[model samples]
Target: MPISSKIARQMEEASWIRKMFEEGVRLAGQVGAGNIHDFTLGNPDLEPPPEFVESLRDLVVRPRAGMHRYMPNAGYPEVREAVARWVREESGVEVGGKHVILAVGAGGGLNVVLKALLDPGDEVVVFAPYFPEYAFYIDNHGGVLRVVETDGQFRIDFDRLEAAIGPRTKAVFVNSPNNPTGVVYDAAVLARLGGLLRDRSRKLGRAIYLVSDDPYKKILFDGTQYSHVFRHYESSIAVYSHSKDLGLAGERIGHVAVHPAANSAEALVAGMTFAIRVLGFVNAPGLMQLAIRDVLRACIDPSVYQRRRDVLHGALTELGFECVKPRGAFYLFPRSLEPDDRKFAKVCLGKNILIVPGVGFGRSGHFRISLTSSDRAIEASLPAWREVARAYATV
Candidate 1:
């Protein structure tokens, strides 16, 4: 049987991050895993909090029947209610159980929201240097992805964004403490984006929604504050994950919170629930849903990530790589010394180090280094990085 054209096209454009990880594995096999410095994937090296594991064990071993069975297409009411309470407490918004939908993860939540809202050929606007998956998610539902360039530092360019929105624009995606750049959009910038969307919606006589992908909501450092988009834009939905925050990436648990004050909030939520069913998630894993209800407020300590960040940032800068000191998250986007970022990545690989080229994330002349490795890996990788920089310096 022949594969569909759409699936074939998507396969041709698979994530470079995954590609780098595969290459690293191959290199490791060829030249002993201990010798290669692989920082390609953002898989956290930290263990999940002991309390979380304990809670999971307690839930799984309990004598209650039907604990493993599917409950609702959205989720168990109690779990959704607990999550809604957390959102209300954090954002001071009036959210109820009806407004929350449990998803497999932030990735699943995003796809569900896109499938629920996007009609064929509808447009979704995203800032440049975004998480590459945003394009794939939009295209999965036959929506056109419109990428708007940001300022030199990757801050939102309001003028360019305003020009991109038109009658067909369905949603705008905002990821703070962003994946590639790690640049968090401040309050003032969010306020301007709110005004732009409001005015554009009025002019076009259609409501455009804001989709906030917030897996890194709690992974901040250096007193950085991430503005809640729902506070700035009324037509906002928060698709959040417990992966980065709780170190539960493999568990696949997250939610979509449709702002209570959003226009047609009820309809939007209903559509999302339906999408969750049709997309075959059915519901979030039963055990994880129960486990997160008790630990929604808990997160992996920022100090560990902070220490890793400090060491990596200092070493890279001293080696003559210009990197935007990340305010949050466990990744650093460093400008490549050479104009060809892919070539720069190749150079690093030649030194038994692996990183992702920034061209995959809509920017060239840069590369991403994940700071989620062990301290030993970071310590061992620096001299090799310096060596690569020196080689490029001569060229």
Candidate 2:
């Protein structure tokens, strides 16, 4: 039987990260895993904090009645309450259980929010060099994605963004400590963005939701500052996950937080609850939700990633590669040796080094390197990288 046209199209546009990763695996078999330096995925190498493990142990041994059973579509009331208090303390938005919706993961939370807010043909604004999955998520909800290009430094280009907002625009999405580039947006810029959204909402006579995808909220380096969106934007929803900070990517534990000060918080929250159920994620995993509830403040130390970043950045720069110094996240967006990023990535692959092309992230003439691998792997890959750089220079 033929597959659906939509699935075929989506498969065609699937992640380059995974594609390269699979290639890396195939190459690993040929030349042992240690010989192939794979920087294709942001899969953290660090283990989850001791608190996370201890919590899981505590929950497992003291299994209460219905501990593994289904929960309300929104999640358990106690988990929601715990998340609410955490949000209140962190963001000072004064939310409660009514405003928190547990989700499968940050990606799942984003899908739930889109399902709740978007009408058919409505548009969701996203900055360029964004997470490619954003397009699929918006399309899944019958929403159109409007891509707005960012500045030279990958900061929001307000001029293009303001011009892009029109009557059909339903929401704007932002990912701080952004993927691909690892540029953490400044607080002033976020405030300005919130003001712009407010002004546009008034002019359009409707509320425009600011959707903040912040899975890397705590992965900062060297005094890099960060803040919650609820502190800046009124009509906002924060999608968070334990994937990056707690190294719980496979656990799929996360939540959607609707700002309490939003114009119609109650309705949005209700829509999110309904969306989670209808989207086939009746509720987030019961066990992990309970496990994460108590470890809200726990995170693996970021120093390991930071050291790796410094090592790779310094080594690559010395070899003549140009890249922005990443302030957060474990990825580096560096200019490809030549303008054709795909060709450059292929050239690196020939040397048993794997990296994703920037075209996958909506940009060309660049590539992304995820530094979530071991320091030994990075050190091992240096010779191959330097050889690629030298060969490009000669050509």
Candidate 3:
């Protein structure tokens, strides 16, 4: 049998990042690994904190009877309680175990939330230059994705966003320490967004939810503040992951925190639980849930990422590339030297350097560079970047 038309359409739209990675691998084999510089994916080369590994070891050897068994669909209550405590301390919001739903990861949490909220033909407002997967996730749940393009800096354009929210809009996806751009949304901007949503909700006589996709919440640098969206908006649901913060991307552990103060919080909680089951994640991994409870305070050293960010940002800037200084997250979105970002990416590939074209992230004339590589890789890639820059300068 043929694939469904919806899935077929998704498949036809290949990920530019993944495609670049494949090309990088092929080029690396041809030119030898020592010669090629690939920054195609944000897969961190850094190891997880020692505490995470230690927690995993302890969990493995423990005599706990239900270590591997599925707990409540919402997840192990103790884990949720621990996470809620952390949330309360961080966000100054009163939360409890009942407000949290453990999921496979941020990606899984997003899918679950979308399933819970989206009715056919419902509209989801997404800021452009977003993680491309968001479009796929919304479409998966029969929602229409309404993209709002930001200013050149990729900062929130309130006017454009305010105009996008209509009666059919069910949710808005906000990614801070955003992927592709790495620009953190300021608190004032978030407050404005909250006000806009509230006004629209009142006018429409219905609630419009804010879904914060915040895997990079804890990964900030240069003393940047990351806002807790729920504090700014009553109807916010946070989908967070330990992948970036704890350097446990492979662990696939994370949770969804539905704002306890949200309108219809109880109904939303029930819907999230049912969505978890229907999405086939019944519960987040049992062992990882217990492990995180023990090491809830553990996180990767921000300084390590900070140094890498500075090095990459400095290198690109030195080469005369224009880029928004990433306040957080380990990515640099440098404006392409030419109009055709795909062609510009091809030129970089010719120099044995791999960076994903920004067009993949719903923007053109820019490309994303992941700083999650080894320092050696960052240092080695400078010459190729210089060569690419020189070529552009001469054009």
The model with the greatest lDDT is 2
Superposed by TM-score, candidate 1 places the C-alpha of residue 344 at a distance from the truth, in angstroms, of 0.8
Reference-based lDDT, each prediction: 0.88, 0.91, 0.88
Q: After superposition on all CA atoms, how large is the RMSD of candidate 3?
A: 1.3
Clashes of each: 0, 0, 0
- lDDT value for model 2: 0.91
Badly placed stretches (over 4 Å) of model 3 are none
lDDT of 2 at 142: 99
RMSD of each: 1.5, 1.4, 1.3
Location of the lowest summed lDDT over 10 successive residues in candidate 1: 10-19
lDDT over C-alpha atoms for residue 99 of model 1: 94
Report the C-alpha lDDT of model 3 over 42-161, residue by residue, as the tens digit: 887778889888888987777498567767899998998998998888778898999999988899999999999999999999998999899889988999999999999898888898
Evaluate model 3: give its TM-score.
0.97
Off by over 4 Å in 2: 15-18
> Per-residue lDDT tens digits of candidate 1, residues 220-320?
98999878887888899999998888898999999999989888999999998899898988888888999988889888887788888899899888888
Between 1 and 2, whose lDDT is larger? 2
Q: How much is the lDDT of residue 180 in candidate 3?
A: 82
